[model samples]
Target: MLRSSNPLEPTTASFGATDIPRKPNYDFERREREKTKAAESAKKAQAKAEKRAAEKGASDADQSGGS
Candidate 1:
């Protein structure tokens, strides 16, 4: 019987060959990141708008009370 020097090489003929793992999908990962980023941006924008509206309302009330 012949023996392979490399440890990675399968020794026995009866044993099935090992399948290599699939490579990472960079495009899919990038798209997912972009989606999360867009969602966060939208959320921040909404909060900012709400804060601006509240400040505007407060100022208007203050002006009316002062007059």
Candidate 2:
């Protein structure tokens, strides 16, 4: 019974296949959770890289100072 000028829009014709209202398939909650997780992961990786670089720089400085 959905009314729309666009014939492409969903109607009772496909009602048997879906139970939920027809709309874009986007899970905002899931996307937000994923985005948060990704940001945390990126932060952890950056912290690790910085720590490694700092260790390397310290080692280089120590070696130069000894010689």
Candidate 3:
């Protein structure tokens, strides 16, 4: 059996070199979530405004046609 000559050298696992996991960036993740929420809210608000405008126009047409 071949063995490492230097005891101080790092030993490798049978699979390969061990990998250290990266730490999560909570601040960046929070900012991204906030941005997505804001965009969705804006979209919903725009749709609601368009629906209100359409209803108002239809009501005006009905009143003029009935007169």
Ranking by TM-score: 3, 1, 2
Q: What lDDT does each candidate get?
A: 0.95, 0.88, 0.89
44 Cα displacement, candidate 1 (Å): 0.6
Residue 66, model 1, lDDT: 100
Query: Which lDDT tens digits does candidate 2 get at residues 1-67?
Result: 5688988877666655856776665798789889999999999999999999999999999999999
RMSD of each: 10.2, 9.1, 10.0
The sequence of per-residue lDDT tens digits that candidate 1 reaches over residues 9-64 is 88899687678898999999999999999999999999999999999999999999
Residue-pair clashes per candidate, as listed?
A: 0, 0, 0
* Residues 1-67, model 3: lDDT tens digits: 5457898665554646457888999999999999999999999999999999999999999999999
**Which regions of candidate 2 deviate over 4 angstroms?**
1-26
C-alpha TM-score for every candidate: 0.65, 0.59, 0.67
In terms of lDDT, the poorest run of 10 residues in model 1 is 10-19
Q: Which regions of candidate 3 fall more than 4 Å away from where they truly are?
A: 1-19
Candidate 2: give the clashing pairs: none
The residue ranges of model 1 lying beyond 4 angstroms of the native Cα positions read: 1-22
**Which one is best on TM-score?**
3
